[model samples]
Target: MAVLMEKKFPVEAGAYETAGEVSTTIKRTLKQLGVSAEVLRHVSVACYEVELNLVIHSDGGALTLQVEPDKVTLISQDVGPGIPDIGKAMTEGFSTANEEARTLGFGAGMGLPNMKRNATEFDIQSEVGVGTTITMSFALDMKG
Candidate 1:
């Protein structure tokens, strides 16, 4: 339950200029921490996917990465216009991305799916008028 290290990055909605910067920093930090390659890979993919979601979907959000002795946790909390249907959103090839986001080659409807695939554990919570919070955990062990 104790964190060994933690880093937080603020993501602005529609900030296409610096979408993946935080995820890049996270990968570097995990590598420097001597985390295994497999675990780092999972974390990197999920981190980027969630970060991009904040940029392309949320009004704005903050991403926090916490490293514990046994696991790595990536939490993304975003504000406003939350997802209406979690079931539909989870379906592949189902996207409601704006024209700008689609033009940028994003919003292929793979963000949530990819995050779920990469993380050992994934959970999401949201309300219609509120915000969305996604938490993904990667176990730092071979057994995972």
Candidate 2:
């Protein structure tokens, strides 16, 4: 389906200074669009998690926001140095984040797990030396 509204934000690697900015914008946009509170909260959490993942783990990436009549979708696609094991990456508390990322209070390893938990539908694909792509959707309906 065609997107009703869309925005893209570039996430620089290790850019802790500006982390969560994209997600903040997304949350505001959804609120302006009159998305339900429950769905907005879920999308906010998922978007923050994914955006932080891009800053902490990726070489660089862009987060895309798509709004449809029934749902909001967030897609994060990063450059090289992709994940080696998708299964391991999905595990809570399992993070490949470096000391730099960790020192900044990031890399707690909850990014992927939290995103999956908050999103109505989540998908992640990665290939070593290639890139990683994560897609998360939050439904507009009040029912989970």
Candidate 3:
């Protein structure tokens, strides 16, 4: 599991103005690396969802992209205030988004659910006072 490439992008909470930049950059980077379209699409969607969660939730954190020979991994780690109930958070249409986020048409409570749906594998860890971390992996088809 040697990493071929890696990049970390810092995300600020409530930074709606720069919300999708990190994910878009990740998508472009993967495209330039010749990743398969299916994998790219999955990564792109999951990546965007995680990025948005960072902006809308958490205090601030980093989104990391790791590219290996057979898979792409996205690690999103954010500072407090953390999720107390990960199960509830993962449920579709369940969100703690504030009115501002809703006004921007950003938080539909679909972030975690959508990320899990798009990624090949998904895991989330959160501490009420510590922070939250989400890891998602998309398997690449290198056979082509």
Candidate 4:
């Protein structure tokens, strides 16, 4: 599929000061491009979830947005301390978030599950000591 637009934002670990900015920018960009409200809503949720995951879990990473004719894709790639258990992590209430994250009310173990639930297609890959990458795609409603 040909990409109509693409943007990447770098996320710093534990950077609570600027946590949700990237996802907000993504949503706004998509909205400015005249994307359907349904698709924009899904992308917003999944984008926020994945961006928070990068901040709370991974060392550091980049979140990328790609807009295609048929779909919008969000890719998050992080550096280290990758997820050890994919199955457990996928559980709705399973969280490895530290006390700091908990105090901020950010990590409720719903990030991954919510991202998956909001996207039309979701895929995650991780390797111990390497990193984790999550890719989520939302199919655009092109029937205007």
Off by over 4 Å in 1: 142-144
Cand. 2 Cα-lDDT: 0.87
Q: List, residue by residue over 27-87, the lDDT tens digit for candidate 2.
A: 9988998998889989998888888888888899999999888888899999968988889
Model 2 segments more than 4 A misplaced:
142-144
What is the Cα-based lDDT of residue 102 in candidate 1? 87
Tell me the TM-score of model 2: 0.93
Per-candidate TM equals 0.95, 0.93, 0.95, 0.95
Model 4, position 33: C-alpha lDDT score: 89
Candidate closer to the true structure by lDDT (higher is better), 1 or 3: 1
Candidate 3 weakest ten by summed lDDT: 135-144
**C-alpha positional error of residue 78 in candidate 1 after TM-score superposition, expressed in Å:** 0.8
Error of 3 at 100 (Å): 1.7
Give the best candidate by lDDT.
1
Task: Report the C-alpha lDDT of model 3 over 10-44, residue by residue, as the tens digit.
Answer: 99999998899999999999999999887888899
Comparing 2 with 3 on lDDT, the higher-scoring candidate is 3
Better of 1 and 2 by lDDT: 1
Q: For candidate 1, write residues 13-127 as lDDT tens digits.
A: 9999899999999999999999999889889999998998999999998999999999999999988679999999999999988988888898999989999999999999988
Steric clash pairs (candidate 2) = none
After the best TM-score superposition of candidate 4, give how far the Cα of residue 64 lies from its true spot, in angstroms.
0.7
The candidate 2 region of ten consecutive residues with least summed lDDT is 135-144
